[model samples]
Target: MRKKKCTMSIPTIIECFQMGMTSNEIALQANVTARYINSVLQQHNVERQPHSSWLRRYTVNENYFKTWSASMAYVLGFFAADGCLPKDLQLVSFSQKDPKILEDIREELQSTHPIKTNPRTGVHLLNISSKIMKEDLMKLHGMSPKKSTILEFPYVPEEYLSHFVRGFFDGDGNINYKKRTVSFVGGSQTFMEHLKKRLERYSFEPFIVSKEKYHRLFLSGRKTVYHFGQWIYKDKNLYIERKHLEFNREKLPPDQIKDRPFKAHKSAIEARKLKLLYYYNLYRDFPEACKSANIGINTFYRWISTDEEFQLKFNSICNEKKI
Candidate 1:
């Protein structure tokens, strides 16, 4: 009698082959002959990679965090801001809105793990599952699960400290054009204080302010912000593209830039007041408008009371809405 053909799915066979399983191993799982497994892979245009290539595919430099190179420092800082390590898993994961930084980080870590995207949020994530890597991050770097509120700044060597700060900035910082400010937000008050102290060492007058849920380190004024840009990006190898472009725009002449006046800080405040007023007009609700404008309601009322122009504009908006 003729032998019945194997009923295993072709995709499953191909998956096994792609996962570096030998034909015999796949055959054993699929209950088919080794030749049948090979036939399915061949039919699906799956060429066999050498064993060495397979080894390289799944392996990463587990000791990558042990040294203090610029790349390592930057990655560590970025991880401190955007990465996560679960207490129960041997996994370290990073999520970013920009996938390019994630790709750079993967190369820096010598990891071949796939970068996956969340369909719902369009955020890219890279997960590396290695016990050694996770432990190294915890023991050497003081990173812990649920570290957002209590994380302490890690000990970065003096030479690579700028790179580390730049990495953290790329992850949790903002460059405001209208305000001509560079600000960093962190969940840990102590962490923000540490960062503020470091900035002071460079003669920068960074100050910390408490927000509702976090702390902010602010470096305002065009000259100060520009100097900060220079300091962080002096020897940069990796950075978020959009933020880099934003800082580069500061190089333009004062007349060419429309965001802020060259020497008048009042223009920036006026611009912010006008923006908040505009948001209020659109929403017709003070709290909602404040939320949209990312300002506190107390600040809004202060602006209304202190700035006659802003108060008049707000009154006009409210009157129009009443009509």
Candidate 2:
């Protein structure tokens, strides 16, 4: 009881974690710092996991994903270093004994590689697999599942599954995600139903944005977007690429073999599509909107000023007539 008074609140710590908040992320979100975040966690005896250091590290799962879900508390990996996908993506069961479906899965994997005919998995991975399937994705991803650290938000609603964020991340132009998640709303059953229904059917990738933005922007609270091609999901429920996990050349389960095989990142992936979607729909203007949204103008400028794509995205949204 006495400990609670001297240190930060437990909800505050946990909420940050659930939101896919890293030490740097938490500092920025909660108006603190990396050291301070560790200090607080220490006070509470909360341990720091690999995904704990945001904007600084990147890696992925070892075995198949275990109870992976696209939501809070789930950790994802980003491309910290410039590297090609693992060889497994390229190593299809070319042998005669290979199952046709598994061969096709391997063939599909081959094309997504950045290198020609050299199939590498990808820069990141997400543990969306739950129970058995998750195990598969993790095995494919090559890392441990990020533990449910802590998530705390006093006012975010539960129904809205997704949205967008403009200038709330880091300086390099990348941003973290905080969506409603597949599990939180209905867990794997509902998530699988929706995921299966939408595969290849839509043109846009369903992106995960800031939960706080949805509450203020869309009145109806319909959070989630259906996107395709260049735009992809990140943040809590996604993975970029990971480290320290092992991979054993194995075959995909017969059931999953026929399912839409997860493909690697597309060639020339850019922020253009995401920007268009954001500005045309979810983007709010500067200054007043920034203040109200709790986003600083400095942040807004930092992102747009340095990145050409970001500027183009913003300018196109605002209808710049050109100077």
Candidate maximizing lDDT: 1
Alpha-carbon lDDT, every model: 0.79, 0.30
The alpha-carbon lDDT assigned to residue 169 of candidate 2 equals: 10
Quality of model 2 by C-alpha lDDT: 0.30
Candidate 1's displacement at residue 263, Å, is 8.8
TM-score of each: 0.65, 0.19
Misplaced by over 4 Å in model 2 are 1-280, 287-295, 320-323
Give the per-residue lDDT digits (tens) of candidate 1, residues 1-323: 11255655686667445545578866776677897777777778886766413523676789999888988989999999999995544678899999999999999888888887867899998877678889999999999999999999889888999999999998999998656788889899889889988888997666665546788777766766777888889989999989988888766674553334423577456545655665676579989878876778888888889888778778888998999
270-305: candidate 2 lDDT, tens digit per residue: 222242334333445455545444445665666577
